[model samples]
Target: MIHSVLESVMTANGIHSINRLHRLFFKLFAWGIMGFVCAQTAYAVPVDTKSYDPASGVVVKIAGKTLVMGWDTPEGSTELTLNLSGKGALVRSITVAPGNGKPVEVLRDIDPVTILTVGQRDLKKRGGWTIFFDRTSRKPSESGPLTLKLKSAIVRSVGRRCIVELDGLEGQSFSGKLRFTLYAG
Candidate 1:
């Protein structure tokens, strides 16, 4: 009888041990799945990027209308630089409109506007470039605030066109406008 009792107790203990092990494995699997899901959620892609650098610069002219600096941008690129002739005057305003009829100002601070200069020599360096517009000011009218229009154009293989608007000082005299358009392309 004692032997039978001992046998029963051993069987019950074995069963309990097996159940505990099974529970532990289940918990570990559940935790792993949860961790994977959390990681995926934390690594979502950004809706907009702050800057981009174009690999090349393309000169675009529209018959008698205006001249456009164009290039192909990477899939996630959002920013560009405009190379302008510093001979005339420092640029006061910039416009980028993808399709909208009105123009938009990309730059706001007056300090950086004074840094742009003439000739390709100075423009080659990235320091001469400035931020004109970004995703923050993408939709001016929709935001219900008075914001500048961002206008740009994509033509064939040339990609999109970025137009820079200039405001010169009253007494300042420049030979011509040398504008450089830089962006992530």
Candidate 2:
């Protein structure tokens, strides 16, 4: 009877140990699967997007202000023009919005300048555009809220399209949108 009791006790302990090991293995597997799923979901990229053509209509907003912005190249022209002449449309009006959602006119007929220029690879030509705010009118009525209205002549370059990037206007970085349209003339 004593031997039988001892045998039974040993069998029960063996069964318990096996069960504990199985449970530990299951927990580890579950954790690994959960971690993999979380990683995949976090790093997944979004799909399905619309194409933006700068030629149609481009509106750039910076610090809660809208500005007209785009580029134009002469027809059958291989070179980029820096001088803000009849070559392209310049930024005209600048509107500033106050904290209370009220817009105040700050600037009109704003003069734009080209700060940087780069040459084309094949033609070895350089071209770009930049607009500068008046030094006297740099101060805003409030802390934030500014907008810009940009106008440019239609781009007429055939081989390469002009690229217009707006920056260093109000703050450290350039924030805005661009719309471009191609015309026969």
Candidate 3:
């Protein structure tokens, strides 16, 4: 029935080839549908669905705030938090690299390099998962994961947050990016 109707429209328009008319109809139909959908969604907010990388599972936050590595931020300053969401997902490694390729340094006798701390956060659970970095190894200048002394068993599930405390000398600022990889435990 539709083919006959198309043939009649083609005949009326002096178009003889049914194939050409069919193709033209489909093309115009597709364009009309696309235009309608675009017009409907033009005012909608764009969403990023593929932001989660394979290695990072679901990166809740990436460098939330700019942090100066070698500067002594006041006490209670916002600690860097890496929010992860996955079942049985544990941090396999965290590698740090300088943003400018220069080594992250905290010069002694010039700047105050304060204490650095990393902790496993499960608000529902108690506080048995905190690790303080050794003062000697606190000056990270290259790309490498921390040799965590604690066992890797902290699982980040729903409603949990992992926090790391970073502070260093105040003289020269050390800026860097940290990459964290996770694995199913």
Candidate 4:
């Protein structure tokens, strides 16, 4: 019935080839639907990744406020937490660009988001970020994940993004984009 209706419409438009016109109309219809869907969700799409252990949990507290973040079982594994302080929008986005052309991960909430970026947020108070990392390696000098317990850190916006300068026990320092909630009243 649909094919007959399409054929009648095409024939009414003085088009002799029904097969070619049918295919063209179908392609146009599919493209229109795709375009509409993409446009509706273009601004809401943020690159994210949440493939981590579900048993781990992070508890974030600043002043009297407390927020529980996602899973991260860092026990027995090298757990490196950076006490970051700086100026930017207070956000619940945690991202790590493991360097070496790695795909950035957005570990946003307690669920999973991996990569955090700077955005226009309404920050109420001034504070810092305490970020955690699972060190894949033992030594800081090695080219893998390093274990460090650094505190009193600060994040400075160098250019397009904001980064927190990291210094470990081995005196080796590295920079990474760390954006999270700064709730110090």
Best by lDDT: 1
Judge candidate 1 at residue 158 and give its lDDT.
23
TM-score of predicted structure 4:
0.24
Runs in model 1 lying further than 4 Å from the true structure: 1-13, 46-54, 57-185
Candidate 1 structure quality by residue, lDDT tens digits, 1-185: 64565467568786676566667779999999999987664441121111222323443433222223443334322223332222222233444544533445576323233232222233334564643322233333221112212233223222343334333322123322223445424
Residue-wise lDDT of candidate 2 within 135-156, one digit each (tens)? 3243332233223233332222
Q: After superposition, how far is residue 169 of candidate 3 from its true place, in Å?
A: 44
Q: How many clashes in each candidate?
A: 34, 20, 0, 15
lDDT, candidates in the order shown:
0.38, 0.37, 0.34, 0.36
Model 2 global lDDT (CA atoms, 0 to 1): 0.37
The true-structure Cα RMSD of candidate 1 reads 21.6
Q: Which run of 10 residues does model 4 get worst, by summed lDDT?
A: 74-83
Q: Give the top-scoring candidate (TM-score).
A: 4
How close to the true structure is residue 161 of candidate 3, measured as C-alpha lDDT? Answer: 28
State how far residue 133 of model 3 sits from its true place (Å): 33
The list of candidate 2 runs beyond 4 A from truth reads 1-13, 46-185
The per-residue C-alpha lDDT of model 2 at residue 20 equals: 66
Each prediction's TM-score versus the true structure? 0.22, 0.22, 0.22, 0.24
State the number of backbone clashes in model 4. Answer: 15
Off by over 4 Å in 3: 25-95, 99-185
